[model samples]
Target: MQPSGILETALYVTDVEAAAQFYGGLLGLEVILRAGDESVFFRCGSGVLILFNANKLKDRPKGGLPIPSHGATGPGHVCFSATRDEIASWKSHLEVHGVAIESEFDWPNGAHSLYFRDPSGNSIEFAEPKLWNLQ
Candidate 1:
């Protein structure tokens, strides 16, 4: 298996620009790619956040927002790893935005994590994984 690792996470949003502002302005992500009225990609460490124009999908005759089928099947969450200090800051940042904290944990090695969701209800987290490989 070629575990090259995940490259990005695509999430649906009502407003792409607003999502960018929340993620980029407040969360310190950098917009790496943006095609007006289509999609915008934000950089978070080695990963990317892909946000699409919600209305554009609606304007199309064939495709609307993607929903789970008969049961939860495919994509679920997009986690961003952060340093210990960064995790603390992220916890406060999300709190200030009135974002609900779904959970928090202190790992065995003392690394920490906080889970929450975006405006579109996609579950996301800022974590400090104790065992991450550079390779």
Candidate 2:
């Protein structure tokens, strides 16, 4: 295999299925591969993203995955694009689900974006790009 950039980001989540639901169902990503209780690999663009059991990977973080912590979520966020309607849909979905909204920022490009945390408290950004063109 040839060398390349980060092909995956594997998070140790409390609930893998929930992560899949939010990232796959809500975010509209197709599930690429899901293995038993071990881990799941997702097809994202030209690469893959993964989620492993934090408890299982605590002892050993395979494939350069982040080391599991007692409660630390580290830093930064994961971003996803949305269809115009989807972006509007998320505001309601998150509120109905009881997830706290962190902040919503407007980019100079006219992109409309919102930030929120997942069940595992990982930062996630949902964005609609057409707003950028408007800007």
- Highest TM-score against the true fold, candidate: 1
**Candidate 1 off by > 4 Å:** 58-76, 107-111, 131-135
Query: Where does candidate 1 clash, by residue pair?
Result: none
lDDT of 1 by residue, 1-135 (tens): 797867877776766777777777877788889878567898876778887766665555545556432212222477787877887888888889887899988867666778887765667877776635421
lDDT per residue (tens digit) for residues 17-82 in model 2: 787887787666778888666567888877777777566556554556465344235543666667
User: Each model's C-alpha lDDT?
Assistant: 0.72, 0.71
Per-residue error (Å), model 1, residue 118:
1.2
The Cα error of candidate 2 at residue 49, in Å, is: 2.1
Scored by lDDT, the top model is: 1
- For every candidate in turn, the CA RMSD to the true structure comes to 5.1, 5.4
What are the clashing pairs of model 2? 109-132, 110-131, 110-132, 111-132
lDDT of model 1 at position 15: 68
